[model samples]
Target: MTCARIPTKYGDFQLCYYTNTLDKKEHLAFYMGDVSEADDVLVRIHSECFTGDVLGSRRCDCGEQLDRSLQMIANQGAGVLVYLRQEGRGIGLLQKLRAYNLQDQGHDTVDANLLLGHGADERSYSLAARILEDIGVKSVLLMTNNPLKISALEAEGIKVNKRVPLEAPVNSDNESYLLTKVQRMDHLLQFAPPSKPIKQRAL
Candidate 1:
């Protein structure tokens, strides 16, 4: 509905606020440089993660991915980050927190959601595609590990030129979570051997 210029450490961007009839939620488009008709525009379709993105929770890599995507877009000087409001993979915050408790009880991310009677990933890409089209993005070099995102966007008629991997740091807390993404979701990722924990010296 409105566009505003936002200056960040990485670069200045024009943030466009969008209100779509699909979900009628406030989605956003943060773009740097001219993307109105640019080919091979870099794009990242990010779902909202309140805990990870805001509080920097270590249980997942969502915060890192969000920051890394912004940095990458800044470096390119011409990219778009479609911030979708699909919190907790679209199960909403309440269900997500409950699922986290389930995770602590020894369930993987997917299974936790399934236990909550929700799909593994309830997030949709149609809103993201519409936002991209509204922003006039022609084709994109999508930064993601999820092949399903690429397919979903394409299915929604967004031209994906190539896949640009946006991997994040693996930590003790999120190790198994990332593994489930690879093993179950078919995300294109390879895990490095976990770093050994440092032992503290006796005082």
Candidate 2:
């Protein structure tokens, strides 16, 4: 593990980069304040999304969720945001782009992945559980809309005190994609519409 100070618009964060035995990909942890020995520390287990996160693409809500999670953690004064290198829901960039082309051709995200011979989401959280352990976070108030992420972390021995909804603004481009997540993938986004208040989900 290598640690460094990362200055972002949100605030100063201690960024730790890691190479784990679970996969060849390098993972990252960007945290603020003292998360060690903390319970109910806000956490976001984010999978990498090149288009949405970096390019600010509106095709999906990844960038918005990433930004929202960080701001939430920063405001809370103590939290961890884990960046898992699972691009495009773990299909890798090339295939993900291919899947996007399929999506453009009228297939939804899930069908696009299935057409490309991949699971709806191939990412794993064992590494995230390991990262939180290394960071000394006793338990977490996980920021996410995915219940599967909560279950996965618990399965890997990370205690989730509760779930904090990390939803993003709905837009025309991503509305269908987001709806697909709720309809097909079972992601909790009852507050997906712009008018609804952020709803909290208990673990």
Candidate 3:
């Protein structure tokens, strides 16, 4: 495990890089503030989401989660954000876009991927676990709504002390998408109670 100081526009952060034998891949972790010990760390293993993250597409809540995690870690004054480069759930951008095309034809996210000759999710977290170990994080309060992330990290011997949920505001365009995530993807989302209807202003 080797640590290097990475200078970013936001701030200078300590990055720990390491190679994983099991996955045969290299991984990195961006450390914020002081996180030398185990129990005192807050971590977020963020998978890459290009459409929502970079293009601000309303397909899913990826960008929102990323923003929320950054803000949360900044507020905590100490934490690490392990940004894994697993784009499109590890299917890469091309297949992801193809899946999006299928999705536009009324297919669900999972079915679209399956239709495109891909699995439900092609992501792997072994590299993330290795990176965390390299940084000496024994335990962490994981910021995510995905239960699979918690289980994956725990399986790799990284102690997940707690789960910090990141839920975004649901809108008309993304209501069904959110429902699919909660039901199909097994995300931890407590649906907000229906609010009083607001009167529409006349044009």
On the 0 to 100 scale, the lDDT of residue 98 in model 1 is 99
Which is the winner by lDDT between candidate 1 and candidate 2?
2
Evaluate model 1: give its lDDT. 0.90
Candidate 2 off by > 4 Å: 191-203
Estimate the lDDT of model 3. 0.78
lDDT tens digits, residue span 1-203, model 3: 78788765456677876666565445567777877665858898988787887888788888888777767777887789887778888888899999888888998888888898888888888888877776778789999889998998889998898999888766665665666666688877765322422223111
lDDT of 1 by residue, 71-149 (tens): 9998988899999999999999999999999999999999999999999999999989988988889999999999999
Cα error of candidate 1 at position 73, Å: 0.9
Q: Lowest lDDT 10-mer window, candidate 3?
A: 194-203
Shift of residue 20 alpha carbon in model 1, Å: 1.4
Off by over 4 Å in 3: 1-12, 15-26, 192-203
Q: How does residue 9 of candidate 3 score in lDDT? A: 48
Worst lDDT window (10 residues) for model 1?
Answer: 194-203
lDDT of each: 0.90, 0.90, 0.78
lDDT of 2 by residue, 36-92 (tens): 998899999999999999999999999999999999988998899999999999999
Residue runs of model 1 more than 4 Å from their true location after superposition: 192-203
Q: Show the colliding residue pairs in model 3.
A: none
